[model samples]
Target: MPLRTWQTTLCSFVIAGALVGAAGSATVTPALAQGPSAPADFTAIARERMPAVIAITARQRVRERETAPALPEDLPFREFFRRYFEERMDPREALGAGFVISPGGHVVTNDHVMGNAEEVQVVFGTSTRGPVRLVGRDPATDLAVLKVDPPPRMMVTAWGDSDAAEPGSWAIAIGSPFGLGGTVRVGVISAQSRDIRSGPYDDYLQTDALINRGNSGGPLFNARGEVIGVDTAIFSPIGGNVGIGFAVPSRVTRSVTDQLIRTGWVERGHIGVSLQELTPANAQALGRPNEMGVLVAAVEPGGPAARAGLRVGDIVTAFSGNPVESGRHLSRAVAAAKPGTEARITVFGDGRTKELA
Candidate 1:
């Protein structure tokens, strides 16, 4: 693959596991980082927090290469080669790392780790190991929750305030890097809220902490021993750690995992209105001279917007008192709202302005 392709394609492929088998959170309170003048004990934080970090393996048996090389021109041994050497792949076990989030065995990891594998397992050091069941996954956020039978005493990691994490703040990552035993690397939060174009919800913490293929689901901790981010991806030309890495911030993980744990799904708020730009033609059809707002292209018969008296041809002027400058703006505003909440919408229709809830 080209280097630019590697840069974009490696986002979800930064995986760790061997050729033997297959592949595939806590919100702690923000432990205030050592102030700008001081440094946190990265070693001490790793020791205290490492116990919560565990290795994860998603089993997929033998699989072939994604694309086989083209056959040689004028090959004489076609039958011999085709029968024996066609797409034979190795047995592999996919391995990554995650952390226990609940004493009852709710674990947090990236959605990519679990992939589509049916068998998933977790191990804490060498003593505690068992299979875990997938509870929920939010691909938009790239977060997932797995449920394992609780050990006698599993150390649950606490979530820290990711919003408080600053660029240049100390960042320590501990996980099963390269599928080796737990490894630790120290760096700083190089940046925050990075949109690597992986998904629509692309908020990520860009860190320089050395995370490799196996570090996808590991924790990135602040100075105070709280998990500020979950290491997820990296930009590498050679598929090894070259410093650039990304982690799902704790704020996104906590919100997603909490919902996953409670409801087994994330609830997205939608007002059920299909919208389009109010173009001159559309406005003329609607018998309006102005094309300043969004036009309701369609409305679900029984959706929230319809129930609130929104209909086709309704011009949505505002949402929750904020001006709806464009269809994209209105869509984002509604999607960001919490489900089950009430908000008034302003629309211009029937030759007058009106508000609906």
Candidate 2:
């Protein structure tokens, strides 16, 4: 199934992108005493946290190529027959949501929501609205940060642990769905560690939080009003919220957002190699049916992996002693690593576990 970006208002649907926004922390924040099982002051918490949920309107230029005008052959007067339309790109404004992450007014939202943004504006409510500056964006993770001069009484939201968020736990989402600002919806965590294959790091928290179009880059908070995920996409056949939505987990968002806040863009360590998944169908032929690994399909001659003694036909089982689940898992791990660092790798060859390289 193809997941749309949840970006709208430009002859496109409101549902697109698989996840949204920045997560603040990797550590677990405790839920309230009377958490999801027993509702307590839901309205109050929503009110307190509501200010952090901001609406975003990004105006972007849609570029189009213009070809030279063609003259008609049937016309007696070729000059009169010739016609041309001025080559112009249309400017469009897309609406999404974000939450404040810093006291200095750092906001987080989905990158897809701000496609080629020429200008951006953030609104806290009906009264507070102003132009904002783009801090950084990571399209690979569908996350971005914005710097806004928050109005008086605006507050920031804290990041909760998506890793600690259990299935069936209560979830709250706040965004500008259909450009309706400060809309709140409630549901539960449907599942965790779901891979919708949106990116190299595809671990998404599945929730039934009634996320819809224009909810892109919104915050999905737990019962304690802590942000655990960014509302980005919905799994709907009919474009409306069907209760199945996906969010980018805090564990991944936290790291990416921090880097973005420090720098205008993100940089990742590269290990040049092409990999094919090791699966049951093909693993049997390699004498390793049950074990998980990826086939080293192609190794660049002078690349990091090759220089570290990796060869084509090798089955990469682990990296730095951590088991690699798939090609994507290894790729994400390598990207997360610091550049110019030594790599510890384990592979399979000759029908046995190969020594670390």
Candidate 3:
């Protein structure tokens, strides 16, 4: 499904139920009995993290084409209308959000927000800082790092262990929705490890938080006010918040942003091979009882796999002693590896098992 930018308000209603006793007396049940207790007040958490959540305004140069004005069919000016149109270059501004990740002025946000920006500015608590330098951007994860000379004292948010994020856990989102700065919204983690097909490393944390267009590149916080995810996209049909939004997990964000800050670019290990899921038929053909691991569909010439003698029809059983459960597992494992590091690869092929390094 096409993902839309999220923005708007959420309406909620309460339904009360009554129980009747044998004496015809009605008893009212507590609303909390239906589910978990009311969530604790997020006011403290929001107040603490709101300062770090900054609004971003990116300006880019764009081409604007002028359309010819309509003319009457019988009017002699119809042919002259076509000659008056022209294209002009103009500046366009895009608004989004970001959060400070370090005291030295390192801010983290979505790449799409600042990737194409010619001029970037950050709005923090009524103060605007202009022309923030783009430290680096990783399009694969839709994350970016920006550097600015922050005030003497800046509030920085820490990263939480996103792997600990579970469904039904409380989630808070702070951003500038529709150019409204310092907006706070709360929800629960609806899901984790969601592959929304936004990118190859798409381990997104799904939430019902009120994330919108301007919320992109903002921070999604846990109950402890730690950053757990970076708001990126939303699944909306009406170009507004429908309670479904996706954010890049902080685990991935931390790794990518750290690299981007330190090196201006991300270096992902590449073992050139096309992989497919191991099918039952292929497992049977290979004399295996069950479909496990990933099948090597093709090996690139002169790449790591080719140099390691990996061949077509070979099933990758493990990577550096880690079992490969599926193609995504193998892909993530391989990409996480440092380039130039020798990896122990186990494969099942030719009706036998072999190890390659």
Candidate with the greatest TM-score versus the true structure? 3
> Model 1, residue 115: displacement in angstroms?
1.2
User: Which tens-of-lDDT digit does each residue in 120-205 have in candidate 1?
Assistant: 77878876577678899999878999998887766889999998989988888988876775799899998987878787567789
Q: List residue ranges in candidate 2 displaced over 4 A.
A: 1-37, 63-88
Off by over 4 Å in 3: 1-39, 66-86
| True-vs-predicted CA distance for residue 248, candidate 3, Å | 0.7
Between candidates 1 and 2, the one scoring higher on lDDT is 2
Can you give the TM-score per candidate against the true fold?
Answer: 0.69, 0.82, 0.83
Error of 3 at 133 (Å): 0.8
Which portions of model 1 show Cα errors greater than 4 Å?
1-37, 62-90, 273-336, 344-357
Q: lDDT per model, in order?
A: 0.78, 0.80, 0.83
| Residue 129's lDDT in candidate 3 | 82
Ranking by TM-score: 3, 2, 1
Estimate the lDDT of model 1: 0.78
Estimate the Cα RMSD of every predicted model relative to the unseen true structure: 13.8, 11.7, 15.4
Best-first order by lDDT: 3, 2, 1
Give me the displacement of residue 191 in model 2, in angstroms. Answer: 1.7
